[model samples]
Target chain A: MENRVLEEWEIKEMLSRYGIRVPRGIVVESLPEKLELEFPVVLKVSDPRIIHKSDVGGVILNIKNYPDLKEKFMEMKRRFPDSKFLIESMERQGVEVIIGVIKDRTFGEAIMFGLGGIFTELYRDVSFRLIPIDEYDAREMIDEIKARKIFEGFRNIKANKDSVVDLLLKVSRLVTDMGGKIDQLDLNPVIVREDGAVVVDAKMVIIP
Target chain B: MFEHLLNPRSIAVIGASSDERKIGNVIVKNLIYFGYGGRIYPVNPKNEIIYGHKTYPSLDSIEDEIDISIITLPATMVPDAVESCVKKNVKYVIAIAGGFSETGERGAELERMILDKIRGTNTRVIGPNTVGIYVPRSNVSTALTLPERTALPGDGSIAFISQSGALGLLTMDTIAEFGTGISAFINLGNRIDLSENELIKYFEDDEKTRSIVLYIENFKNGRDFFNVAKETVMKKPIVVLKSGRTSEGARAASLHTGALASNDAVTDGALAQAGIIRAYSETELMDYGKVLAYQKPLYGDRIAIVTTAGGLGVITADYLVSTEKGVGMKLAVISDENKKRIRDTIVPFGSAENPIDLTADGSTEQYSRVLEILNSERNVDGIIVYALFQTAKVDETLIDVLEDNMKGKPMVVGILGSKMGKRMILEAEKRGIPAFPSMERTVKAIKVLYMRGRYLKRRYEDGEQGS
Candidate 1:
């Protein structure tokens, strides 16, 4: 709401509004005497202008206890004095997939799906569909990608296909609800476990 | 509105000449040789007669209303010719000149002048920098190529549109050679008056066009064209082979979404959204046209390949099953009942599997019998019949049985190699079955049929079909 580029928390809030589930996160403006939460949490810097969080030493993962959390938190605070930070529970390891939306000038709203996270950058394996996609189109898009094999599970994991389909349909609906204000949206590293999937990270760019 | 362009009743050849080497001479000669069933008025200031037709000094000299005026003159004189056409109430103008837009500033200025002249008038121009159109049914061809170079089209269901004139005609030659006919061919060089959007509507309105294929470099108005394509695809499949797919943005892109989704990715997505099938090559475009023009869109991906040879069927099975999961089609599991029928009908040693091999000993009776059993099986979405005429037992009779059996079902045919094979393939095509010389091409056509079916299913589910 304050800037053209929405930060991670803002994008997550937007996703929550569209019925897309994101990992539980809390933005801490001030450090308390004691942090009350489970271990194995992720802390990421919240900044609308910074596009890549990990590249800038802004993302800290796997702090097992309060001492480690506070130590990493203070280190990050010392590194960037003015930036806000968000701490959330780290999601269980699952198949990571990328779901995105790009407003094509020819066709109005186009959605993209593929294997997500760093490998998405390395391999560039992606598939696309126009918005207002139905359950059938969602299923087809899920099946169309080369990385579709990831959804079938690997190494003692079961396929979480229904969750992937639900996510795609929600993304499709989100594109429609954005009403053309949404220029692009990326939910990279969406953890898909056997039970369900969650948006581990999200970034959206409006008309800027 | 483009009906006159496709079915011009009378034409005036503006630079008609008697010299053999001149473009005007070749156009006039080509028109006469093709048996164009229309009145031709040859206009030339220098000649009193051209090819035995009485030549007038100008178009206004003709009393009849001119439907089209073919101008083969210098770029500077094109505007004046259009002025003449406007006065004559010419419905279409094919400017067979090359110096507009392609030759830079001065030529672009001349093109602008022609555009200025034809504004708010009935005169619609095809090109100022290119060749024109080809309509097989009407025998109306405005391309400058003579009889020796390009074979004229036979009447068929494909309506082809191309941005490049020469490429369009050469594609025409290739497709015509492949035993498919074109309903209409439009060369849209320097599309001054008409672009693809309006022509798309024109092709959609024409009941004769069952499928439309396009060769595009870039669109004049991409969104506008896509909107029209969305409307047309449910009724008739539009296959496009788009050029100019360079990874120009990959270097500047900052995110995986941006880098992975190239211009072509966006284009392909747009095309898919519109339900228009995109072909990667001209041959695939033609092959898609052949199947689309003849058969109905398949309802499923379960294909039943019936072949005389085992190797062809094996190869086809590989391609169909080798694709990614969603679009990957399977060889329909031939029911035991149908297998028994094949055994009862064909030789006992002949296989009764999905690729029901009639063996090298297959004859017309066996082909028809296997086709009947397959046709009766509801599990079979489409069939690919391979007729090897070289087997010494098969003859021209196979074509008759094939045309009869394949009438209502979606299908393609593959014949053996050689002159005999080409003849049989063309023979089957003449009777309205898409026949090819190789299994690869035939299976590819079948794959297109399956893709069309999937698209139709998606369209119906989306309810855009009613729109």
Candidate 2:
């Protein structure tokens, strides 16, 4: 089967349909007259070909006004001539974590939950389980990570563990519902606040 | 389900020989020495007497119907031998020779031929390169190792299944030396036919088996193995020691999820999800097995440490509370009323804190009284009693005290390793109280039981939530 990565907006749209929270975003071929979103928005090139958008200057964040949004959108469009632009309201930072699903060759459809960024890259602190998981498995995955102490309130950060569990259960269901169509799905830096979790960035690889 | 393989009424050693060095001789000697009750038929072309019993020239000559056949011939000869076993209608065949699929293409062809002969027949095969099985309960053993070299365990509850023959035998010896008994030991060399999944289901219903331990290098069907294990663990605990844990899967990964997963890390989670305790070493394999087999699941994490030595008490407490190395068990707080009750049992100098030190001069009666008090405390979920037999007042009677106080809650013993300590451990095991030679091992065994408890609780809630 040929695998293809879906555009970020499409992936986020799919996530929201499964009852997962995603940033309110829009994809446009050109800068719009006025945006429906609030101030302080983010503009990025929504091309599946670009994996690390920020690494290649495809992303510009924290645009406080429509003028900056329009300026950054034009600049991003100029940098990537063939790509469409994605504009969204900027989100406040929270505890960063990654939740993903991969159709594993051996175990098949396994869900992964781990701390995002350095904890994932350096410490490799993560836990996994075969998909179609229930509330019990979701709860256990939270406690299985090495830095589980973070969930109970680490210093100034107050991460809601229940929201993470809810996100995990929904992802598990999404993968289960998609079945063989999804090869991999990553919700990197899923901002987890005391109130709830939102998929700040998403990249999904689907079987075409 | 595998009655012919597990509880055969009669067995035939096809490559029966008189030479002491041969595998056939070792198998025959093990069977006779271990006191197998069923008929033993030795088949060889040479019509001679062997092991004080008449040998049949071929399997067909055994008129009573062979329940199983142990084929100890060369790889090239295995297919032909299997053909004859099938002709004789043998229910199961244990081919003990190597050089089958494990060798190369020629061997693979032989394995296929062997498989072809058994297809659509009532017969089943265990291995073309395997040491086969050892069941102490029925006095039946097909292990290729010399019986005198290893300390064979007697009939007990733990059933071990291994993919490697030598490791299985070596661990069996260690488990035996540690005073833990075995219900059965099966080696899945090359896994030509029977797999661990089937044995898991069989042992789940076996009256003699209380816990199942597996050492698998790879899986024939991982999903089926896990699914069967998930169902069986609700009835009995299953522990697995899976090697090759390196993150080989990460190199080929295209995403962070795949990259973060070492095949083993995913396997570890899946095993836990299925309620199987994962063991990292052979010692840990039996350590977890013996405890899970003998004791009930520890339903809570609150642990109380009772020791005669203050230093041992302090270390045990550290191990229980250290989340870095330990399972982060809470040091149970004993109420003031309970402390007063324990204080009256020990000497004036003895401390009645969480460890409840009884001092060096603590007596057997004092240990028993303190344990009785802790066992009754609702806050204390489990108890660890570190007994120093060298103390003047303590003796083998401490084992009886531990056994008696083991009524309402779970408890383990930590004894210093010595000649007397070995005897105490054996005695404690005989009475069904898991006693370890070290404090860490004792505490870690409790962690395994605690994990089992948590899994059971999760599963119970799963059922309560309706699936």
Most accurate candidate by TM-score: 2
**Model 2 Cα lDDT, one tens digit per residue, B1-467:** 77767788999998999888888778888889888899999887887778887899888878888888999899999999999999999998999999978889999999999999999998889886888888887888898666567777878899999999999999988878767898999999989888999999999999989999999998888888889999999999999999998737644556777777778878988997899999999999999999999888999999999988999989889988998877788999999999999988889999998888999989999988888889779899988889789778888898888888778588878988688888888888788888899999999988888999988998898798894
- Model 1 DockQ reads 0.43
lDDT, candidate 1, B1-467, per-residue tens? 77777888998999888888888888888788888989999899875777888888998889899888999887888999999999888898899898888889999999889989989887789887768888988898888776776775688989999999878888888877756888899888998878888888888879889899999887877778777898888788899999877744333334457667777877876787678888888888888887888888888888898888888877778877776422368888988888888899877777888778888888888888889889888889889888888787888998999889766578888886888888887888788888887777788888888888888887786676546
Best by DockQ: 2
lDDT of model 2 at position B315: 89
RMSD of 2: 2.0
Off-target runs (Cα >4 Å) in candidate 1 are A1-3, A34-37, A105-108, B103-106, B249-254, B324-327, B464-467
- State which docking tier applies to candidate 1: acceptable
Per-residue CA lDDT of model 2 for A1-208, tens digit only, reads 6789899999998888988998888999998787899878888889989977888998888999987777777777778999988888888888899998877666788899999987797988999998889888898898998888889877867989999999999998888888678888889989988889999898888888
Off by over 4 Å in 2: none
- Deviation of model 1 at B249, angstroms: 4.2
